[model samples]
Target: MQLFEHNPIKIYNSLSGKKETFTPIETGYVGMYVCGPTVYSNVHLGNVRTFMSFDMVFRYLKHLGYKVRYVRNITDAGHLENDADAGEDKITKKARLEQIEPMEVVQRYTVDFHNILNTFNFLPPSIEPTATGHIIEQIELISTIIENGFGYEVNGSVYFDVHKFNETHEYGKLSKRKLEDLIHNTRELDGQSDKRNPQDFALWKRAEPQHIMRWPSPWSDGFPGWHLECTAMSTKYLGEQFDIHGGGMDLKFPHHECEIAQNEAAKGKSPVNYWMHANMLELNGQRMSKSTGNTVNPDELLSGNNDFFSKAYAPSVIRFFIAQSSYRSVLDLTNDGLLASEKGFYRLMDAVNLLEKLEVSKASTININAWRQSCYDAMNDDFNSPILIANLFEAAKYINQIKEGKETISAEDLATLTNTMNIFVFDVLGLENVVKNDSGTDKLTGAVNVLIKLRQEARANKDFALSDKIRDELAEAGILLKDGKDGTTYSVN
Candidate 1:
């Protein structure tokens, strides 16, 4: 039987404002969509926490034996700097400042995003779609909305008719906002602007002459709105109605709100079964703002190169730190919090490593079945990772008790405990065992040695071009390679 048969997971639906028993539209399959990053700059730690939350959700769902089609869309275009209808495209803005092509900026940061995710042991989504790649779909969606009378064209741009849509549909149901309240709060639109109301968002933006990321459309040569890409890509991949749609809590209004409007206008039905929002992340009790100089990027934290953290933390330690909090609660990350998580993370790993050395007794003293079920029960309750982690520590305590001869497990129960612990700790939690010798620098050393050996082989084969390229790349990463007559050795600065 599939593990999901007994799991019966519950998800807190942001749309419904309560936890609901999760029932996939398909019998044993799930369709999930998450809004990915706007790759204009290096991804911050907040983005990491949001993605990591969904990563844990994805991991747990798969562990329950459901075939999941997870689709996360990359906002390569159409993401304005202010996250609204009218501002410079973030990628385009970065390109102009750096004097490079917009796609160059996208490609560079997308690679960086992937590298960071890989370092933190994140599972790649089943289908990763890009916004720029789905422009045709977005254009078609806008045409459908316009034909359905929820959209109007002014000048060269198309905007969603919020008042018209509200007459027939609830404009802000997901955000739990009323159209009147939104209108009352919003300032009146000036006659000089193209929008009919301040609440009406852009469907297609009219590109200025200086805008380099424009695409040809029926209305004009322009780009899609920031919110339109998620609707287009999510609908195209996950269908008109899917299982779950997730993003940061900050995107609940306007970004996700506009997505609901777009999909409802075009598809004529609600687009998602469960709407999930991961809460915000703060650094040292304050909002992580770039202007205040109180932000810590993933690279900085991992390398101990920033002023925020006391020492270098491994990727798994950071991942563990994030998983300790509920996704719906704002997580305040401090040096002390990370330090506590570091100790806890190693304790869990250390217990797992000692499983093989544990001796089995004739009869079990503890209820292994109950302990295993407790872990499952914790996850089944809205993917409550903090509770699940607490259960993990319970088992760790049992392991230590068994090691000290204060507790005993039967051979059958020991096997069950070992398998269950492995699944939850390594597979479901998505944490890797740390190297005790170097506090996790051994992996980097092993990787660098692989490259050094490849460069040596290239030199032996008289491929100086390949050899020189390897040397130059390692030099850029602060890994100095000294190739003596004996062999090549490396040192990190």
Candidate 2:
């Protein structure tokens, strides 16, 4: 485990409704399940925020030497317009509109989904299960719920008995809502002539003729419900009892709450130890949603077609922009905010490049150990990434000072600082500078060399004013330079 000196990581557990110290179920193994995207369309920025937060957690746990089996499921089927019970699956709807096979929709967007996540530098999960791959497991789970008297089948459709589950198992415990509120707030469920209560959600839905994504099951030619996919796939991969379950806060009620009842009904025990929810991403103080027409698709942003962005942003900058804020808070997207984040990101990258090149002193002037501790402290406290970033920025400033001959570092301290920055920023946070595929050209190399030489001559002549002006001007042209004790090195921004 390469954890820092002060790695007492605390995280806000939605299960306990408070921040608690994180300890995996097993001594050195962690089982984490995160709800993944429903492959109906392109994933928006709001959806990516949740994954980014979990990436931080997953990376940190791995960095701490925990053998973590991270599972994030893809909903290839069963997610519907009005929850799982109301009617048509979302993917099916898209297929109908596009006049394509349902699997075509699944394959296209699933590929697109992976591309976007990779662009943002998200590590692929240990197990990326699709709902369509585990139909038998979902059927077995529905059967168990029925045998345990918490689910009922009518007209070949199975619905969980939420009201009855509430009587014995506290159905609303996860969401902190009274059963009465749910009943009142829930409008009369559609296609619910078979359900015993309005709050009872489907565990298995009997597919109609137009529904093309169903599997043949004991119940009928049907598909698993939206919540059933997560419950079945996670338990099958991670186990009936696991450490953590995470998703967007919008899934708190009905989605996650129903999942709890389904798992308890089948397993006769709580499925997860900790519940974590990342808040939604907001746009102009309003939620960015598909229906609201304010969603920013990653592909659109990458192509510079998003109305909110005037120019295309590199993937690393977009990743950092989301990570700069705490996961639990809503990150409101603004052009000014993103521009500021771009500058900070480049500054951080510049310092990172300068760290190893720094000259070592006999004794330390800046406290690298304290800075390292602060980085761990921020992460340990519920994976507070913004604070971790702030600490990294402080470390970056010191690195810049040492590069500029303003501070000094011991040889031992230099190694520690390098290791700390690499672990926290690159491995744990999963941020990186873009690596462009450029064939080395004589013209390009000559131009860059000429600029560096000119800067060198300016510095040798005690022309501090000229040196700063050249640096600033070249920076605006997307060339960043670091003036080291020995010489200056540069990288294209």
> What TM-scores do the predictions have?
0.87, 0.91
Per-residue error for 366 in candidate 2, Å, reads 2.3
Compare the candidates by TM-score and give the number of the best one. 2
Quick one: RMSD of model 2?
A: 3.4
Off by over 4 Å in 2: 1-6, 83-86, 435-447, 454-491
lDDT of 2 by residue, 1-493 (tens): 3443236567788978998877777777889999999888888687888998898889998888778999999889847676434458888889999999989999999999998999888999999999999989999999899999998898888889988898899888888999998777887644667878888888888888777887888888988888898999889998889998999998998788988888899998888888999998887678877797877788887788978777788888878898888888888877778789888988898788777568899988987888888887888888878898999998998998887778889999999999999998899889885532122465665676687788889889999899888889988998777664676666785
In terms of lDDT, model 2 sits at 0.84
lDDT of 1 by residue, 323-371 (tens): 8999999999999999999989877887887687688999989999999
lDDT of candidate 1 at residue 70, scale 0 to 100: 95
